[model samples]
Target chain A: EIVAAIETALGGGPLAGRRVLVTSGPTHEPIDPVRYIANRSSGAQGTAIAGALAGLGADVVFVTGPAEVPPPAGVQVVAVETAAQMAEAVRAALPVDAGVFAAAVADWRVASASDRKLKKTRDGIPALEFAENPDILKTVARMTEGRPGLVVGFAAETDDVVAHATAKRARKGCDWIVANDVSPATGIMGGSENAVVLITADGVEDWPRMSKAEVAQRLAARIASALGG
Target chain B: EIVAAIETALGGGPLAGRRVLVTSGPTHEPIDPVRYIANRSSGAQGTAIAGALAGLGADVVFVTGPAEVPPPAGVQVVAVETAAQMAEAVRAALPVDAGVFAAAVADWRVASASDRKLKKTRDGIPALEFAENPDILKTVARMTEGRPGLVVGFAAETDDVVAHATAKRARKGCDWIVANDVSPATGIMGGSENAVVLITADGVEDWPRMSKAEVAQRLAARIASALGG
Candidate 1:
């Protein structure tokens, strides 16, 4: 019956009944007009997730940074560049059913972004001051009101991946953490397939590597299950 | 002096005194002409990691699945297709200081592959017998001879990501597992960027999402630190 209900919903589900919020891509901390600190994140994952959620009978608000790929179809898309912007967008989209923080948010941003490009005068060395960005996952998890029923964070690591991810779930105060090694050799960052581990308070679940599309489909199914969709 | 000496060895340092073995990409199980069961991994992350390891001065042996991307410069590259082939290659390149299993290995293979393509059926799903493939991480981790000092596995999940990863690491007897949520919308499988959690018996470490390349650099540094390279 539950499955039947979900099928019915997907066939013509009411988005007015459910809302989801997601974040994706790499946040940039500008040092100058020509140079900025950023990682390689296309935001494809986040946008794809938003699309999947919408398909599964939810109203999705996708908050994203600049990405190489386009967002998925059929949803309310909110575009943002910096971590702060992404955070603001997320905060506004709350009181939703769920939240997935898939964005590659920079931990540190320039203390003060330069108004113009910094000139290099062949100095011995130059140092740029940095300040930590707001922890979006922690923020939402700790929200007093308008909080989503579910909050998930992604941990990109290199060593002791599982142990660290489990600890992160606690530290971030989120319900779940998805862990993966980003070692360049894994091609996990900008490539076409991934091997991932899901972490939660209960323990861990390791899935065999699969296509990103497969991951999205399964996750949508699981999220729907959680929402009683 | 340490850095200079290491750089001299490979025109680099850290990895100079280390031997690193890495496995990446997806295994293809051919079912028939132009038809094979395979994951959608491009081997970009894995190869980049090998490059990062090399950059850190480790002598890397990159055992890879068929990838469109070329191996990073300077590392010893061994290319293979099937999981069995990859296993053989890894075993042959053993006696390394550390090992990372980043490949999205196919869990099963066609029991008997057809030499030619089969005709389409009128009204039925095609059935194919399957056999479990050997787990490279488990095999290497349990090896009594020529085993690398550190062994890691990749766990991809959609639901219960961490719980399943923890169990897999324990079962595989690996030193660590990189857990990731490859849920579809996240685009974690391809197009660059990832959010991952590092898991181990000690606990979880949640890292902000980043490029697979950046993750590789950090991981290499960690390995070097651990080995005192």
Candidate 2:
């Protein structure tokens, strides 16, 4: 496939013989058809990642939520919207070499969905009940059968970004957690560029801000190098 | 002001006595009226940080490049485009309690710009020259007068993510470097969720993945918590 040629051109085909699965964007939690809870995620990071992985020669399966950008060519793409839908899609696409749960899936979903959009009542307000959604990262990380060799999760923090992220990695049972402060001023979410910290059991590593695409390229290379172990 | 109230409601009123400066988004390096060399960066992370800092009650000055989204409600907003323009904005805005260089400034720019878009040559090949751009984070971090109490730079990495990021923090002369693997698969760019690593002289600390908004909130809170030191 021409895709194979492109991958070889990028480098040594770092991800050669590896299978990678990635999640991207915000998973919607619907209160009603017209009203849903969603974060401001454009999915640029996710799609860029898919391209990055393919460029490294990985057989990548991208499970994406709704995104403004097109998915990268030459990868298996499964699209979904809600948190539950995303979880299912990821589950079906697994048995990969590695997994990165980068999606901002809502922590909670409406306890019940209204088939129709809820009308604005004459009363001042309306209360919608909710329940916790499945933690996809945790699920995959803890898989008993054919678990990916590496599982990474994202922990976005506004305060004590490192502290909370460290705890999260332990709680979620993932091998790594990438943390960042996404305060509105940082312009990370729903934005094109990002600044983040990578938290692993070993320690933390800081970075200078750069284009997300460049970041993807480098990460793919690193993952490929790690595959030799 | 209502903006101040929103800050309090957002759980960042601790910044009341502090002063903070933040830079967000990508700086456009213009080559012509219709075209420019610019990285893909939305102002989400930086803007979120500005909001978080403001919420903590800090007197915040937000220096931003071209961003699609509106700046958080209650902070001083300065909009610039080119990396040079961004540097100017930061110079005017600094001398704060803390400074966060969260913007994804282009590393290089066209050596010269054409007043109009250049037409394609008959041969269909054009040569464009480039030069290194200013290092804003290093400049501010190494300032002689009224230097910020805390200065942070972001490290966006893909390969040797942690090792490279740690080196960047030292090169930039910042107190801390927040590193993220932007490998296309990591999805830190243009995504709602992020994973980060924090690197200091002592060691690295990895954080968990969460919503970008939460990351901003936690980072701001930590900054405030470290106010006395």
Candidate 3:
């Protein structure tokens, strides 16, 4: 790791002159001033990937939500709370060599979010309306102008992991999709270990369960190669 | 602090031989396997209070939800995820001398929570149904048998702090209510300092803004006095 950092400092790695963008963590959609809807992602895998990319000499821009793990030391961190804010941040950090969308963003947000805390009344529970959040990965991948050279999306699926991820890659118009089973029994959502399936135009490759850092390093190397660095 | 620990070890403080129950943190109500609802409580105040009570030689059973701050040492910690589990834990630690309900428990949980992660489909947004959660403080305070000598509740209010908390005290039948303005402007919801108003049978006493640790120590001392320690 020290050697990698020294090499990056000397601008000597394969990705020396490349700039990359990574979005990580779970976006919190607020229902009220005090309460919010969140996901189980701890951002461990995303943070590790950002660190790995930076270690390989890529100037990384990490747009993150309120994650349990702190951001890596050498990346430009843009912290956000909601899907809208994350999308805005991603738009602002554009024209990179590659884009990695790893955040577990909420599909919908409470359309009727309240400024005041909702109280229980004799009338009964309040009705919560919902609205769709921005599809950040698809927006970036389908961009016609100034799009990243390679766009990689992530799919956290409970069932039909490969099929879901493969479909996601096509639907989002991304170059690659890193798929994982995040079922509670799998313990991959917040755990240190991950087992991922890489889905590309060519085919699928299932990687064995390993530490998040190892998965990140392997993925970063693949990205470096794909970017022709 | 070391003297306090030594005194507690020697059973020399005023609260020696007393058994206290303290509930802290924010309860997470799951909406699905990957998504859930949470609040902004960091649990700093509640953790400090538990530590202060233990410092005074009390035997403390700390019932906590998912909190940012860890449980204090010298107390038996019972960790829980949701309000229902927290209520069950509180019920199990019964017959104590006093009970401090400091947890920012969710009043409502998604009754329509799915076992599987909800996907975005052509069906538009999924409708969410809510149900009232167990009122832990009120349930314990209104207990007919095996009731603690004193029951204390907390209110995090955005407006009319004293009036709301005073009404809560009457409604819940708790002995006292520790009320605070948690409006975002005050920065008290997740910040270190607090300005609170204590509502009792006598009247409302507004405490000046102070560090959370100081507030905890003062409240612990008050509890000791109320219990005739």
Candidate 4:
């Protein structure tokens, strides 16, 4: 209560009355009871973004997978494991001022996940069947009602990041797309700093390589100003 | 330094003069510049085992993937990210008294990993082809020269835990197989407590549900006794 009073008295960074939703980490799509498909997302960027939003006094709902880093303080955290669970959590945290889909959600999941541990036999190795996962960003972006005022997505690309992200922005029907070059040579996939191109309706804006926290603060400020804070 | 001296003075449990190798966490196999396939192993049990062995005064080589927890102190930590790299590390840490194959190694990797990030095209979502990963435990257990005296494997099973693990012990040809039920109801996948059955040539030993640390200590003790420490 004292912290809330202080934030209110100091005018609370801007976006004070707004609520935001952010998704981070890689979803684990189960192949069986013990094994699942996952990615190398440490959830550094998404966690930073949630902290930045909360620092700005926004009501933040952070839907995260089994993140390597712990979730930030002062936010509503709903932990999930699989992509399907993450999508459901995102939908449940809807009707916000903005939604940032930064999670590295798996595009496919085992179609027939086994109830038992997969056995290696004399017959041969097990062959897994896969099915496509639901597109969470597109589903929320294409929402006819109860959609967030601003919808943002992330594109982790290796070649021609700007071009690919621009195309992705249109196809996903999201307001903005933050794209990055994740080539191994760049050492950025699980790194601390990031260089991104923010693709908005106005134009593409290139951001210098900076810490994830800086990126989050800049994005939060832009969102506040756009929301007439 | 004081802690090390104290352990050294106490003769460090039963496995004081022995050496052991342990693998932990999930391996990531790349599909593109930014995306990869992974698993949900947290490396908690493996980390505990490493700590326990070190407490027992064993020269421990901890080869781990991108584990959630930091490696235990007073041990050689060889960090890796993919199943192939982990296999290489395990081989390099050979000539030990015991080897614990606890990592949730991915069964497959993308056969033709793209040098560039996979773009979502108008044609459709991309199709990924997988190739089987090498059987690390089996290869070591079947080694002709400089093999560990005792090789322990872990099986995370959903159903028929003891039966499957017994079969696994014969198939892998390892000294012992520690099997656990990782069904969702058990809450053992990412949980702190574990219930495991130790399958050895003598028979199956059912262990009560306990903390990961206790499991590690008990397993380490068993390894020490088997290794004639």
Best by TM-score: 3
Per residue, candidate 2 scores C-alpha lDDT tens digits across B1-229 of 4765676777546677688999988777765433454555677888888897887788889988877567998899998988999989888886788998888787666678665434334454245565667889999988888889889788766567688888888877898888876655667777888788878767898879877788788778767876762
CAPRI verdict (incorrect, acceptable, medium, high) for model 4: medium
Model 3 alpha-carbon drift over 4 Å, by segment: A1-6, B1-6
In the range B31-139, model 3's lDDT, one tens digit per residue, is: 8888999987999999999999989989999999999998999999999999999999999999899999999999999987787777778899877788999999999
Candidate topping DockQ: 3
What's the distance in Å from true for residue A171, model 4? 1.1
TM-score of each: 0.49, 0.49, 0.97, 0.91
Cα misplacement distance, residue B200 of candidate 3 (Å): 0.9
On residues A120-205, what C-alpha lDDT tens digit does candidate 3 reach at each position? 78898777888999999999999999989999999998888998888899999999999999898998888999999999999999
lDDT of 4 by residue, B1-229 (tens): 3664587568765678788999998888887765676776889999999988888789899999987788999889999989999999998888888999999898787889888766555555677776788999999999988888999999988888998899989988998999999888999988999999999999999999999999998998778788887
Q: Each candidate: fraction of true contacts kept? A: 0.00, 0.00, 0.71, 0.59
lDDT by residue for model 4 over A93-157, one digit each (tens)?
87898998999898878899987777765555677777788999999999999989899999888
TM-score of chain B of 3: 0.97
C-alpha lDDT of residue A29 in model 3: 96
Best by lDDT: 3
Candidate order by TM-score, decreasing, is 3, 4, 2, 1
How big is the positional error of residue A88 in model 4, measured in Å on the Cα after superposition?
2.4
Candidate 1 residue A222 C-alpha distance from true site, Å: 1.1
Q: What are the candidates' interface root-mean-square deviations?
A: 23.7, 23.1, 1.0, 2.3
Which regions in candidate 1 have their CA more than 4 angstroms from the true location?
Answer: A1-16, B1-229
Q: Put down candidate 1 lDDT per residue, B148-229, tens digits, no spaces.
A: 7888788767667788788889988988888877655668766478777788778888768999887777777777876777
TM-score of 1: 0.49
In Å, residue A155's CA in model 3 sits off its true spot by 0.8
